[model samples]
Target: MTRRRTTLLTGCTALALALGTTACGGSGPVTAGGGDKALGGQTVTVAGVWSGTEQENFQKVLDAFTEKTGAKTSFVSTGDNVSTVVGSKIEGGNAPDVVMVPQVGVLKQFAGKGWLEPLSETARKSVDTHFADVWKTYGTVDGSLYGLYFKAAHKSTVWYSPGALTQAGVEPPKTYDEMLEAGRTVSDSGLAAFSVAGQDGWTLTDWFENVYLSQAGPEKYDALAAHELKWTDPSVVRALTTLGKLFKDEQLIEGGQKGALNTDFPGSVEKVFGPKPEAGMVYEGDFVAGVAKDQFGREIGEDADFFPFPAVGGGEAPVVSGGDAAVVLKDGKNAKAGMALLEYLATPEAAAVWAEAGGFLSPNKNLDPAAYGDDVSRATAKSLVGAGDSVRFDMSDQAPAAFGGTKGTGEWKLLQDFLRDPSDPEETAAQLEAAAAKAYKG
Candidate 1:
């Protein structure tokens, strides 16, 4: 079992920092627009694993904090977040006031190890209300909340190039059958319908889960992550059959079936931009847009567009995806003040600002969908709200370290082996099931 955190979301670290600063001093929704004047009299040292663009963006928030409250923040840049870095810091007694984690599972893992400070009820309600109760309850240990979410990046949606889609004569796909048909049409029109880099097993794992859960129901994936569901269920097998079927049809994916096994995420990214590219629609999260924008200098709507992971039965589930949470270090400076900041950022006002700036969903429920206003962000928010209800965290992210693919190592190996001989669906299922069992044991 491997719990691999992705590197694609470094941009999110900036969003988290801004939200952290914004979160520090609000009341409740409309009533929550104030900050703590007294807390700023002291300087607090903060450390985290953000760098590059994320750091620049965070500085904006820090500058604002320093300006507003006179609270000086000395942020140490920790290049990458690892358990060893956290352990070493705590053991060295050099803890920061707040630690922003890339995933919820890490937050819970640390909480279980008793390294985090429990936040106030105000902090909990402020951040947690933006998400479903399951997310709020799952990360809490010792009956206390330790982390708060600001930006949630949805992974289950599909991104298509608007110009490419128009060239292919395809409208946004709305159903599984329709999506498959669109894939065929694009293939016939000389472009690959789907483009997913397959070097990481979790990349394919995400596709499998989306297909399985969409065909089955949301509960199945949640239960599976909770150790309450079996891997060899009919739904799981059916999903592989679907994958195999897609494999059998070269028209459905970029560079065909072989490309899926050979194309790394980097390769897939490059493949989408050629003069006569082979792929038009790619199944990826909001972060991919940044990569595209960096490569193409285009804004989201002008270049790429995303639609809700087409409603999967019982209407549509809130656009589900992976997200990060910030925890107050028990041993750090300004514990109460950090909590105040966390509370303040989850307000609608901050959410609107953060979403517009950072290009992700802020954990502020009162924010209007239009306020986010990015074509994808607005569509995502609208689709999420329009769906029957409740947003769910990524099953892979919510699952324990071993069960989740957050670390991104073992799953790629597993996927490499699995794709080589997908002739035996049961074998692949058994292998993943064994890994899931090991995760549960841990």
Candidate 2:
């Protein structure tokens, strides 16, 4: 299809807070108050999908914006339905000045409706200088810049318990076949090999993406993502057939298919890292580290560790990622203040605010590695930033919302069905193609 890929933000949030902020290079602490009063009288309202601890960490970033720029910022949680919440507010003539858009497809929909303002020159230039070209490309739509990606995630990671793996006497696998064999070995050791979050269809989509990107390669990945290649294409069938190798084995999945479908994302992670562990591993984005450490009290490096998703057919492992982008509303009462926030978010200083708080990663290339709270985060961020042109955005996020982002229909539900009965790859592929065709056409 030759279409650009889009990324969406994951639900993981920062749980740990860094001690004192150390000066980086010659700049002072990002949150330190300064005399700059350019926005003394401005009040900017922002909205996003974060809640609980995630919302708190994001507020720290907004607080730093106020300290550095002298603007008062108020934030509201839109919950998981960011598009619907923002749309309703806009229709009511009470939209927030700025929004942290989780899905690139939603950003484009808002921009196409003339609800978004093009980036100010200052914000555009800041993004140009700090972020990589791929990030800039993701934020750009129809040759105009609208969104500035602030938070990013490395989605191609498999978190495993060191103690569980050691107990099974099996090292992390290097290839897909090896991973399947290791899963059987781990299962035989009396622990389920994997904690599959079948209840959350998005996790299943991620499982499919990592496998597709590695087996079908990037060209076919993009084609499938854009709907140029139907889901029933041979490449997709191959990927699904390969994934079936794991799903078909009840011993490899904790609680089996039915049990997996009952587990949510956080519960899946807990199954492996919680006090009385039932599973050996969980596959998801790098955000798993936060849940393991904060909720389960497990150290990231020693207790919970991850390996890149194993390669397929002897090729290099692929990196599939997602991000949250910031955009200003055209009808916002505080457009100036909103634009100022975007500019601030593009700088390494602003990114450092959340980076140091733990559980967050930024695409800002200029950000210092030391800003990350731990070694695991530092290494993951480095891999994300260093991937360059080899990186692929989340495939489902690039598709239309009806097909990709919706909860009960399209890819999410269909994949959940596939997880339950993985015996027929061709039948699943045909059903997926029907849903995708309708979504893309609409």
Candidate 3:
């Protein structure tokens, strides 16, 4: 499945958020702009990565919190790759009350470093019945909250142009051979099929990840992530071979395997929404719903839709990569308000708002799948309904910072590069093993 870009974010593609640290974590009446009540009506600074539709949705949560608490709140647009800035503030003793990021593993490292606080008793108790396994295990380490997840988004789902597929006489693919045939048909019709962008290793990594999930089960990925399994597992080789074949086929990718070398994320996005793009099918996350709606003037399900990533034989599994949890610093002067906003995000109403704005998946399990804005969105929600309930964090986040967190630490790059030449899957596996072994301090 195509995952959206989250890291290596530069100066605010409108996402460089900048809220203040509010009050230190110690004891003191928190301060707000004008008159104040609890915590002395103090204001709290929060930071996270969200600009376009994402920011609008988040604002809804903030707006509700302000109305309920009567606390004045404003935000600075923090760019992606939050750790670069937030991590420094934390080290400098001035981290914001709350921080939002996309990858769960990054937050786990911070929690492990002792930079976070356990969720308030009220918050922790509320989450047990409200979230899925992904949020619980991915966000928590040592039973503490580093990531306060608010939604669920899965990849490994393919979004194709139904009309194009039909016009090209290509049926929705159900098997690996069918998928290849579909791609070929689309190509023969002078239209692109897969909208994979490999210039940046991130997109390519997603392809490899999807292959791994389809070839093996979630258990294989989990074991590999934890360094309990070797990368050269037969399943791994088969998946890589599949990807390599696609790259070898000029008809499979837009601009071919080499074309992926220069494809930027936004560019690939445009290829889908723009009138004359190379491809018609893109495997992306919920976030793209807005991009399609606003840019292509189509709401999810109505304009664009998604289908489960097809598996070969008994390779079916429910493997989804989701966002990081929102965590509040323990000492921020307005910890009370921080917690309030954090909890506010978990509500059904908040989930609805997020769905409305950015088309992100909601962590609030209470959200009615019926509430999805379009057919595509609803279909995606429905696809997950019949699958197992387990969600895996993205592989990139499972390693130490040196591997990939606030930066591209080469963990995913290896997968992307090796997928094109999978003959030596064992060697590639060995490299990942060695990398993890060297990076693992525990």
Per-residue lDDT of candidate 2, residues 129-157 (tens digit): 67788888778889999999999989989
Writing each residue's lDDT as its tens digit, candidate 1 over 1-442 gives: 1121121111222323323333334434432223344444766565666777766666655555554445676777766554557778878877776776766667778887777766655555555556556556645776887676656666767777777778879898787667778778877777778886776566776666666667767677677767687776767777677666665566777766567777776566656653455688777666777666666555677766676566443344335666657677776646655554554454565456556566566544567777665666776665544442355566676666666654544344555565555677777677767877777677
- What would the TM-scores of all predictions be? 0.84, 0.91, 0.84
Cα lDDT tens digits for candidate 3, 156-272? 677776667777887778776678888888988887777666655666666677777767878887887776776667776777777777777778778766666567666666676
Query: In model 3, where do residues sit more than 4 Å from their true spots?
Result: 1-40, 384-388, 405-409, 419-423
Query: What's model 1's TM-score?
Result: 0.84
Q: In model 1, state the lDDT of residue 223.
A: 79
In model 2, state the lDDT of residue 273: 98
TM-score of 2: 0.91
Q: Which candidate ranks first by TM-score, i.e. highest?
A: 2
Worst 10 residues of 3 by lDDT: 8-17
